[model samples]
Target: MAEDAIVVDESLGSETLLDLRSLSVTYQTDQGPVPAVRGVDLTVRRGEVVGVAGESGCGKSTLASTVLRLQPATATVTGEVLVSGADVITMRWGELRALRWAGASIVFQGALHALNPVQSVGAQIGEPIRIHEPGIEDSEVTARISELLQQVGLSPSRAAMYPHQLSGGQRQRVMIAMALACRPALIVADEPTTALDVMVQAQVLGVLEKLVKDLDVGMMIISHDLSVLASSCDRIVVMYAGRVVEEGPAHAVFDRALHPYTAALSAAFPRVGDPAARFAPAGLAGDPPDPTSRPPGCSFAPRCPLAIEACREAEPELREIEPGRWAACIRVGEP
Candidate 1:
């Protein structure tokens, strides 16, 4: 019954960079406490790209925000968030500040809004370097900014432009440039491709994958798009109603998902050229349950096509039905 027992993969080895053990987050609202994430256990090894996929309100964004202690003051967090063996939840303010850009950084969605309207892109990117490595010379910081801009496929001259001057894709590149400025060991990208055109999305994603591979940085990419994750991540974790219901290698989880929720999600996003899927893409029948008033047994039972009496009566713990894949369903191995 221990929370950590639900983790699927055991061969992550010693280079595990980010470890989340029984991590939970609850917001103290006027109505009552609303749980956004619940008893989740996850691990991201060095040089690995792990994707957390779910619908908009399924707590993927909350999980990404909580990893860096960016959740609001009204939210109460539990359990551990270890970044390179250090516990972030218990770190002091000074320690957390230092950890923010140096140890780990986030590439948030909506680059147009995340960036300061008044500041130049160069100044924004330089801000992290100045804060994290205080004693570095101005010349060196400027040089680093240029390097980062180029790294993300933007011209060094683009640094002098304000956020409003750049295209959506260019602005996103600026965000990526800022994230890489500190050279953090881990990067959490929350819906990084949101609101961009298809071609632009591919470009931005390509930049992220290249940087992570080139720098050997561990990345946690959170997105509602299973196709995006399947194309970019090594492993994928599927969450429903604030809990991870299925997880495994990207190919297995996306192509042959074991959990009904995961299957529904994958089916919802069909390939562009696939005629069969394009004509009649599958969609889930109902909306996700209300997080504040989630049902007792399986949170997904009400909508699961394969749900049975057992699913409606008792929540199933995440269990490994295959060698490296796990699913939380009573009929995991059954036809």
Candidate 2:
């Protein structure tokens, strides 16, 4: 069944589990400060999965990594990253180490590389407990590790096996179990199901969805796959050239997208009921502008189908088109 996404109307509660305000990230290259993400805002409520979809190099991964402060020193980041009311950027090394896993956890894109290949899966999952819950006994830790493995649909006994001993899907399951080990209030999964077989991806997504429900944890599921986000998230934010182009409830965004970029992205994806029908993705023509050399006015103006001279000279704010739906394009109400 396709889950209808929730639209945020003016009356909708502003209470957020994770809040990102006017966030921007700039990389210091030989060319100078290169902005990867600009003036982006996102809010994920408790127990909801918010999907961030964008093309490669469109800052989806950078945005997710910023929430964890995982980027390198060269990246100049300015913004308020509030998780449960504490600003993540201001936290010191000790505070950050303590806050992570306890406050939020991450399931990185490459589970195989994320896991310690030589270590038993059990140890990797238990590492969080050992660090954060040092007060607990070894017997208690063992019991918790077994329960976590079971929670992610892996056999409890499999924990004793090494990463190489499990299939790709099983490794991903271990990663999810590790993220949930400390019962984190929030989780950031960066293309978590990537490189898995279809059946395995479905299984892993199912486990993640179930965990979000059972644990009441907020989540940010970042990917380029439209259907995956549509099926898994409560809301969707579409990005292009490091800026938000469109955003709304997942169902509404798919059913009646308001932005040209949104329409183009949907056309690129194979429809669920008509998978056999080939979809010739309308690839966005021309390469993305160099980050250090982004054009004035609308960043996507050059690629927009309905762009005009005004679009090239005027920056468009992401505004509500209809209730919860928002688009950064100047032209609206078109097919």
Candidate 3:
């Protein structure tokens, strides 16, 4: 198993499980091409949990979907997306389909909608196993499904129930079980705990954390909730206006944010026991920029409290502000 390092060097043998180099996704719209993700360079090593956190429409989901080539036919994807050293973008259709579960799988949000309403949870969990490993025996598939359900903190019997019959948390657990059926090296969990109550969210996250660790699988968890990421992820990458603004160790990004956007995001989620944070939670003043009509220069400059004349002239590149930490603000190293 790989060591529990938040940042792993790309030079470190084959530890890099997922590598995105200058990855971008643009959707064809009636008006024009809308860029949902732009020049995103990220890597996830084995046995690491990386979190992507941002506000709605910030392209968190787009980045996640693009990794698996799950985007729509109208969307245009460019650049390299390497999963287990295989380029997903150029892979043939047959290879891509075969890679879906065995290479990487997604636990999408809204499990109620993601799962078939009429199918039993056990069947849903076993579907991927049967599809990817067609020669597996029926009895073995049934046993694997039951074992997965139990691993996710659900009773094996619960697998017989339909999606509608399960609670929100139970449905999310089923989604996790389905993702694990293939034992893929990487898992992208997009808002895995969405719509669940606070207690249930914690429970689901705990199960996810345990599974990722015990299986030594790389994981990329996308959520609008910084607190959720901070609690469960080893590192956090902050995205805004379809670009990464900052990334660092989760505790550092949550407690000592460098970029204005990341700082605002961290403050938006107040600490439970902190009296000051509860009373005066910080908030960003404006909505994200339109994808098709992104303004010149920094996309976030219009709403950035510390924006200066230089910020309006060009978009800042993501530069290392500290060792193993990156931020896209020109003022990051300023006094």
Candidate 4:
């Protein structure tokens, strides 16, 4: 049977910005080869927001790293990472360097650490512009810096401030501006809202949301928080133990998840002002199986409350249970 395609509207933007085909990554550790991602296929159009949700160790970050060839030397990657129909894995050093900011960019998870403490935010944002467009005039670079800062909701004056001088949210916005500085077709944001207050998180998200709508830039946001993804993304892909477990429209995945792992994740977040959520929120027990020694059957079976004897026999392939909705579970649609 054909694989289920992610529901996309051609009118939104038919141009494919990022496409991953059967992509897998395994890290060569001192102990053994640890599989971080397994046979994951994803696509991001020119003007869309796709959210990747999963707990730590589920390969969410690894997937994001692979997009820009940012994975470490110890990691072995297989399959294609197509950025605008160009394969990143096979590109030469010169071509890869050129592709980093012009073809795609990344908003790293840690804003303070990612930015250089010594340089001003404006200089940092201008670095990519200068490197990618050496012929650009000084006046144009300054103007572009101010424009990007404004686009991310920061005052142009804030450009003079150092990383430590800005608040957490402001630093994140600066990172976003840096990502947009090159005007790349695709942006991969790995946990863009980490360690901020709920209100600040909303503001950061608002900046990203507005950028997507106004600039028509394709974005793939990776986070462990399902609620954040549910509120911001058009579509959500839920990962578990290095493989995608469920994927569908954001609202449907949050409200009516098909896989047990997705359901557990949805239940883990407490709803604001809801008494039941505050006091009786669901808790998922057990850690993900060790990647180097994963079981033969389902990686989630031992932790799943609905696991059956048959679940221990073989891993389930991701299949479409309904139009445009897919899940990897033998017991999907069962009452």
Q: List ranges where model 1 is wrong by over 4 Å.
A: 1-14
Work out the TM-score per prediction: 0.95, 0.93, 0.96, 0.96
Per TM-score, the best of the predicted structures is 3
Deviation from native of the Cα of residue 242 in model 2, angstroms: 1.6
- How many clashes show up per model? 0, 0, 0, 0
lDDT of 3 by residue, 169-266 (tens): 99999999999999999999999987899999999999999998799899999999999998888889999988999998888888899999999998
lDDT of 1 by residue, 49-88 (tens): 8999999989889999987899999999999999889999
- Candidate 4 per-residue C-alpha lDDT over 109-163 given as tens digits, one digit per residue, 9 for 90 to 100: 8799999999999999999999999899999999999999999989999989999
lDDT of each: 0.90, 0.85, 0.91, 0.91
Ranking by TM-score: 3, 4, 1, 2
- Candidate 2 clashes between residue pairs 3 or more apart in a chain or in different chains: none
Model 1: ten consecutive residues of lowest lDDT:
1-10
TM-score for predicted model 1 compared with the true structure: 0.95
* Per-residue lDDT value at 147 in model 2: 98
Ten contiguous residues minimizing lDDT sum, candidate 3: 1-10
Per-residue lDDT of model 2, residues 1-335, tens digit only:
22422433234554577899988999998888889999899988776788898878889999998887888899988988888888888888898888788888999988889999899999999999999988889889899999999999888999889999999999999999999998889999999987798899999999999988788788999988877888888889998888898998888787677888778777677776765535454566776677888899888778788898988997788999997789998888556
Displacement of residue 229 (Cα, Å) in model 2 is: 0.1
Per-candidate alpha-carbon RMSD to the true structure: 4.1, 2.4, 2.0, 3.1
